[model samples]
Target chain A: MPSRSLWVPFELGRPLGVPDDADFQIGVLKSLLGLFNRKSGPVIEDYPIESPVTAETDAAWSCTIPLPPLPDTTTPAEALKQALLQEVGSLAPWHAESMRRMGRTSFGLSGLTPESMPEVAAFLADVASGENPEPLSGLSEPLPIAIRYMADDAKAYYMEAANEQPGSDSPGGTRMWTWIYHETRMGQVFYDLRDRLASEYADRMAANGGERPPGPPPINPISARFAVRPEPTAP
Target chain B: MVRLKDLPKEYAEGLLNLPIPDYGPAPWTDAPDLKDARVAIISTAGIHRASDEKFAGGAADYRLIPGDLDFAELTMSHVSVNFDRSGFQQDPNLVFPLERLRELEASGEIGSVARWHYSFMGATDPSRMDETAPRVAKLLKEDGVNAVILIPV
Candidate 1:
């Protein structure tokens, strides 16, 4: 049990309410911080307010801009890589703008410059083709982390492109990401790479006496030890 | 307002499958008065300064975020897309709440905010916490922090 904590009812990412809504955000913070006064161990308090966003409303959100089409199914791997390069080239300016607005970015892994996305695409294509892709120099992180950053870069490219329209916001970026990850050909390639890497890592771990390597698990949002089991159903 | 009961069936079912860590009994600790306590935030939000090394493979590594840094200077890089980033994207305070902490300090709600807060990639395997948490506790104690709020995403 945690010594002290507050459970905010917001979705996984947003512990507070809406961004830019200072009053609500502060209220939630104050309530959590107030836990300090309790002279006790293992306090778990729930934030009084509820989350304002819902799956129904979140699902209804969309980006106004359309993403570029995936390369033709029959396109050669080199051509596909070139197409991805073109997409990143077009999206670079917008990616920079988005980063500027956020005042930072999560990109820095793999040491692969934004211009090296073609190589990333080629790597994914190789993985998809059942060929083992060689790791790039200075890219010593686990394969999953490398792929995640590549996918993130792709998501950023698409998001910035969609944000070109006025009034575009985070939901718009979310929608763009959903489309890119679930609907595009490159997305499929990414999925394959992730699957292959995860299985390979699991095999390696198994061979190493089932000891996990020094990294996060393939999936996250690790649950607490306690769970609320449903009551037995009436016969 | 959204509640766990209100989650979609698929999501609710998925949550049911997670392995709950056995934290055993709740070990209670006396806390200082709110107005006299030096508070710090420990978030599993995977946040770090732009110039800091990115967390790799759910590494047990943590980043020390100076309490006074601008919210815009922090960024989330964890691989899990399970959580919604929209709110975080708009206002990092929704997850980190550093700005709000500063406000509380200014208003005397808390004695003071720690010079440094901490963050870890939230999706990390729970086993790693055994080694990491104690180290962080030592650092917080050394920094004179009397209260901590663990925000798990």
Candidate 2:
């Protein structure tokens, strides 16, 4: 319990309502400061803007980047790798533009540069193919953890680049995530990884006499822990 | 904007079922006027400089962000993927609001901005912060921060 708590109805990621809207943000700030004047015990104020506009509520937004269609000439795993690399390559300029325009980015959680998106995508491709390749260097966490951050970095890179498209406004994370999971080959890779992780966990449990093991599990299943939404469609 | 009930059932249930710690009666005190208070932002977004250590799963530590540090240098490393990062990717002010705070300070809506801010990753057990909260409070007091606005992601 706080002496002055402001309960807002915004989404999980956006506590200040709208992005890039300074006036609205300032309004929220002032309302919070107004709580200091109550002259009472604990005060939990409901910020009057009950239904604030947010990225998730931006119905007019969509991804407009021209991602090339996936090539069908190679093995599925190889195709996934090539397709993701091409997508990353195609979005490079727009990501650069986004960086220049915003002067900041939310990438680099995996301790890799934006320039390393391709490497990260390739590694994910390997994961999607059920290969336990060596984890990328300079990662502070174990492979399972590093994979989650790398996947997030890859998503950020793509989304940030897509955000720089000229015509339509940027969609919120919900729409973008749906588009990524259902529409892109990268999404296919993620589905494959999720399935592989699930299979591996089952195998471990079977090896343990069909009983749960003690302590932390061998892997931090992204699907279980992170709860990636928009359940993967049938492969 | 999405309300608690609007979220998916499992996630919504998880949030609703989180254990709330009762720290006795909420501490009360008279606060200085908004025009005279020095404010600091205390975020649970796992934000830090890009080069700083990333928050491991359920790590019970916090990061210090100097007020003078470049906003561009800040990035979030929260372990949860349930929340949206696209908003933060486009405009960090959505989460950190450092720019908005600066604007308020410049316009005299607040007396001043604290010299330091802090962030601790959310989803970790709040009881784990008991030992560290006092140390952070001491630092905020040292920085003359009379008011703090806690933000969560």
Winner by lDDT: 2
Per-prediction DockQ comes to 0.38, 0.62
Candidate maximizing TM-score: 2
Residue-level error in angstroms, candidate 2, position A235: 13
TM-score of every candidate relative to the true structure: 0.73, 0.91
How well docked is model 1, in DockQ terms? 0.38
Residue pairs with clashing backbones, model 2:
none
lDDT of each: 0.65, 0.78
lDDT of 2 by residue, B21-103 (tens): 87876566889999999999898988888888888668888999988778789888887666577778777777888888888
Q: List the residue pairs that clash in candidate 1.
A: A41-B28, A41-B29, A216-B57, A216-B58, A224-B20, A224-B21, A225-B20, A225-B21
What does candidate 1's lDDT look like per residue over A160-230, in tens digits? 44454455334522344455555444554555555566677798799879999776665311112111222
Worst 10 residues of 2 chain A by lDDT: A218-227
Interface RMSD per candidate (angstroms): 6.0, 2.7
lDDT of 2: 0.78
Q: Classify candidate 1 by CAPRI docking class.
A: acceptable
Tens digit of per-residue lDDT, candidate 2, span A1-235: 3578787777668788777778888888788888987788578877778534445456666666555565786686786688788877888899989889878877777778888888888998898798888888876567777888888887888788887888876665566766667666677777777778768878878899999755455433243323454554333
